[model samples]
Target: MSVAKIALVGCGPPSRRWHGPTLTELSKRGAIEFVALCDLDETLAAQCGEAYGVPHFTSVDEMLDRHPEIMAVDIVTGDPSHHVLAKAIAERGKHVMVEKPMAITLAGCDVIIDACQRNGVHFEVAENYFRMPKQRAVIDLIEKGILGDIVRVRYVDAKAQRPFEQTARIRGLTRPFSKFGNSSGMCMDMGSHRLSQLRLFAQSEPIQISATVKRYRHSDEFISEDWAHATIEFESGAVGLYETSRLGESLAHYQITGTQGGICDHQWSHPAIPLRLQMGEEWKDVPIEFERHKVDGVDVLSRIVVHTDPQIVYVNPFREYAIDDWCVGHAAEIMSLADAALNKKEPEYGLGGRKDVEMAMAIYESSLNGSMPVKLPIAETTSYERILHEDYEARFGRPIDAK
Candidate 1:
């Protein structure tokens, strides 16, 4: 098979650490022919392009005009730039792979997805949590029915100084990008991962959602919400309680209880040991190894399943190819998108990113609405709760998110 030609936009922190390493690994393995690196910052673009032995351009339009051979693009730009760049690429009849939260708003996501469909181009969202080998194992156990009917799902991710730094990333208060105009901040950015994990594990559509967004007092003027506590009720009648940052010490834990038994994992973000599984009254400490796999001389991390038991399965991002601490499964996710565009294999998240954004947006809507449970198929286009924006404007005497 001929190597697929790929291009990258945004040579910032995320691309440099998360997506860039994976794309480089793909080029090394001959799975992709990375054509060019594009960014608004000419210096950064040239630096990244030179590192990979590829050409770099400050403008995406100039690069595209010069290289018609580029078959796909990975948009690593900020939330505001996603729709614009994706639309431009889709217009040229090329597949697009965008970072999560797809776009800041449901309307933006709609436009991007619609354009991809209109242009007959593959549009894939980069969401890596559920793709992690350990998380995939939980999915397999749930599917095998050994865990019986899922009764309740509880997940927590707490951290100290989270609101401080993450808000910087969202409001563009830091380097790489600035003031992204995402007023929802941590509740939407990191909250999306929590919701996606719940949604994937439930294997059912969210029927109702209610949340309490921790306030700006815990954060600075840069962001509005510091954390989020959300509950989602699935169509399968299962409940998910997701407790995010609470302005405290760093901590992460997950547990799923079913009719028969339960399981828990302390290390959900990165590779760790002692993934406890229960089928009876006692806990079974099942050892899980994080490693790479091959299918007939082909590196197929997406196809390789981690066996949780005699009949249970899971998948972790390959450790052999990881470039960053948080990006263990990034390359695997990238490869999945490549398959969707080049090999006719559908991406697991395909367009579900729109739904993820919708759900994340709903959390803010719920919090400002007295934590009233918002149902799925949310009708709002703007991301944050209207009340929160009103509060911010009243406090600062100016509109924070004037996008």
Candidate 2:
């Protein structure tokens, strides 16, 4: 079996923590040829290259020109660079996979989509939450009709600042939040993932959104909202409520309600919290099992099974590579690109990433307009996007669409 030849751009924290190791492991397993690494920061690029034992370059054009064998590129850079990098890589006739939110703006996402289309290359967004074992199991159960018709989905997160501050302190970063640039506040950052999950859980497309976004703390230094609440109405008649805060006590709640049954969990991604299901006026603990095996001294999840009347199962395709559950999402993303590049197949989540961004943009647009409801399939450049575009031009001294 032939493997896809792949390279990576961006040697930032995400690369070092997740993408680098996952790519190296995939290469060792003969899944893909991890060819090179690139970053504007030469030192960071060199460090990542040395760690992954791959050639490195400080320039994207130089890397692509030198390593023409690279069939695909995984972009793990900041949100602002996604569009520019993806377009350039696709124009070079290589498949592209970008990190979540696809791009900071709808216009940016369209730039990527148009470039890939003109170049006849595949494009994928690395939205990994729904690919996890537990998430997969839940989706499988939903598909099997165990949950019946989805009626409502809710995700609440509180005290997000605790972890954010801890990570910032450890990294020794003192920069305040910016209105536009590397980060677009909590809504677009983590909210993108949650919005995608909510859509998937409800098994519907968002039609309307009403939201309020506010900043309670760091008013002097933070230009973006630290608290956000949104109510979404989906095409399937399902409703979703999302609330998040960077302040307050730590708390998490995720629940999916359906016509016949529902699921509730207190924490996100904690497998120890057994999924509880309500059926026939009784709420009971659903037996959840994780199949595992030892590989390279690591206990890797092989599959996850949810005990319903008819069993629902999610078997990890990369279990043989010894990828743990946490990195399983990353492995799946890489393999998704490999499959798209080598087999000429569409990615598992091709344009779905754009939909996630659209949802987030709706939330922001609604918030910006005094919590007025916003409709889907946004027809024009949003006011929120216009402000970001102006900010981009002011900071970069170039129009966002400039080549």
Provide the TM-score for each candidate, comma-separated: 0.82, 0.94
Pairs with backbone N, CA or C atoms under 3 Å apart (clashes), candidate 2 = none
At residue 136, what lDDT does model 1 achieve? Answer: 65
Off by over 4 Å in 1: 159-178, 181-184, 218-221, 273-280, 289-328, 380-403
Query: Which candidate leads the pack in TM-score?
Result: 2
Model 1: which ten-residue window has the lowest total lDDT?
169-178
Candidate 2's TM-score: 0.94
Candidate 2, residue 183: how far the Cα is off, in Å: 2.0
Query: Candidate 1 lDDT (Cα, whole model)?
Result: 0.70
Candidate maximizing lDDT: 2
